[model samples]
Target chain A: MKKRDIILVAAVLILAGGIWLITRVFFNDSGGQLRITVDNEIYGTYDLKQDQEIQIGTTNTCEIKGGKVTMIQADCPDHICMHSAAIDKDGGTIVCMPNRVFLEIVGQEDGGVDTIAQ
Target chain B: MKNKIAFLGLFAALAIILGYVESLLPVFIGIPGIKLGLTNLVIVFILYLYSWKEALLISVVRILAIGFLFGNLYSILFSLAGGVLSLFVMYFMRKIPGFSVLGVSVAGGVTHNIGQLFVAAFVVTNFKLMYYLPVLLVSGVVTGLLIGMVSGEIWKHVGAYIRKNNREKL
Candidate 1:
């Protein structure tokens, strides 16, 4: 690798680290809600603080407890959504592309940085 | 010209096979966008051996073929977005001073994930998809570097062969 190649790799690594750090430090569950959407329409929103199981149209199910949400069940062939990490204080997402269902953690006010694009 | 066309077709087929191979493996890290991106090896090789246009053509054909055979329409859209953006980035990076194959491939890999997230966010109408940004970025860099290294080595060999052929033709 040349000088520029190292520089490029270093830059990307630093950027990734920075984003991870920022999300870990700033993303919290204070008034956060788990918003589930199906086919671009709102399915339901659940309080992150609540300990309950969400069955999303028989395609998938998720559980929220102690301010963390996990996809406990999914009918998708890959089961990737269920394998995804829980959305805790750091904020995360679970998507079942085959079923066209997705879940995300959004702050009541901030809604994360991607919302600014709107 | 015929030789180049034949090479391009071969590379495209190779890319599709790589995609199929990738699908056979389970998802890495259980994240949606994180994968070995093995086909990127073919893409990086083409970008170095041929040009951006040929790379773009091969990538599109490979993505479409892979999607139709192994994935759904949604995956095809995601591949299109990622493939095009990565190719575009690699094309420009190649022209910049001091940037080598590794740098170009790295840029391609990183931008590929960003482009995929952009489409996912749009399709779901939710920017919260950005949550995967950090993981995807790290994965991109790692996979890009691996693909870049392999392609760089291949180019060292195949590049000489192609140059000799060109000299003979001229």
Candidate 2:
């Protein structure tokens, strides 16, 4: 309603827009690998180019098909994980909170920097 | 003194009931950590109608009660971070002249999401979680605007009633 209020809203909108642009441009690496972790431990990494099914500790199941990873099923009551969309780009994630399972996409370039410096 | 305590208790209960109602709604948005934050309506109402100290007390007590009733340790941690951070921001913003309730609530909503994101990043040690900022920020603004408008209306009636009662007592 006031000048200050308009400034605050505009600032927030611009910040959000900037973050959206950065994520879209720099973070969306399509050739990313799917990294699955269960109970805070690394379960395994699978190539997004391959099709496979992963079962995590009898609590959740994930499927990688056609270059996308999805939580196919879960034992959690809400099934929020199962409802989450498939992830095929870097920085995307599917989390099963009740099961303590986390799946994320990591671009191949993510670790390349460390390997190159070494 | 007794009346003050009674009103605080009433506000806390109202906040908790609003939280319960929000939890019952199906996730219209599939994204996690996105909610209408209906309970904040009460907190914002208290901020305008009473002192910041009272608003802070009600907010903390409501989050703790909700955590005990329906959440685990993890939920408690995130809610504590979000609720405390937002309350501080809202209180500070309210002190600045020329800022409307809408602006204060908008700041509160956005910061609440940011605070939760910080906790999530710390828990997972993944900074990439920042990628969710855009969605969360937009949702925050929308929900904050809605809550702020509702609270503005409630404040009109409640503020008048409280002023009348205090004047009568004197």
Candidate 3:
């Protein structure tokens, strides 16, 4: 590897590290709302504080209890959705690839970040 | 012309086979979207031994064929985004005088992840997915390094043969 090669690799690693540090420092989860989508369309948004079971188009079922959401049941073959850990934090995401379903926790404070970044 | 077309077909097929073999192995990492990117070996090899056009053609054809055969529609979209972005980055990086094949591959790997994440964000409509960027960056470097090293070795032996055959045909 040449000097420029080293420099380029270093630059990427440093940039990645910087992003990670920024996110970690600002990371805050205060019982955010859970947003779910299916096939790239909005399915529903549920309050994390509320306890309810969501049946997502017969493909998967998500249960929210004690301010945490988890995929309790899914018809997808891999069951990777069900295996994902419960999410209650500001940016935690659970995705069901087979069904094209996605779930993530969005805090009120960070809502503007998405729009601004876009 | 015939030799170039045959070489393209052979490389495309090799890429598809590598992709299929990778899919067969169960992912031990819990993180989604992480893979060995074994098919990239073929892409890197082509980029060094041939032109970017040939490499790009092989990458696109392999992704489309493999996606239809072994993956879903969503997968096709993701792979298209990642593969094209990676190829673009590698192509330009190879032009830089000081960049080695390893550097080009690492850049490709990193951009590939960024491209896939962009698609994920768009599909999920969630920008918070950026949180996964750091992990992906590290994985991209590690996997890219390995793939580049392997590709370099393969190119050392096979590259001359391909070039010689093309010249002979001409």
After superposition, which runs of candidate 1 have C-alpha atoms over 4 Å from their true positions?
A30-118, B168-170
lDDT (Cα, 0-100) at B170 in candidate 1: 19
Model 2: docking quality category? acceptable
Instruction: Give the per-residue lDDT digits (tens) of candidate 3, residues B1-170.
Output: 78777878888999999999998977627556788899999999988877788888998899899989988777788888999999999999988788888899899999999898899778778777888899889888888888888887888778876777677662
Per-candidate interface DockQ score: 0.34, 0.29, 0.27
- Report the lDDT of model 1 for residue B36: 86
Question: Higher-DockQ candidate among 2 and 3?
Answer: 2
The fnat scores of all predictions, in order, read 0.80, 0.69, 0.60
Task: Write candidate 1's Cα lDDT for B88-139 as tens digits.
Answer: 8999998898988888888988999999889988987866567679888888
Q: Which parts of model 3 are misplaced by more than 4 Å?
A: A30-118, B168-170
- Model 2 alpha-carbon drift over 4 Å, by segment: A30-118, B167-170
- By DockQ, the better pick of 1 and 3 is 1
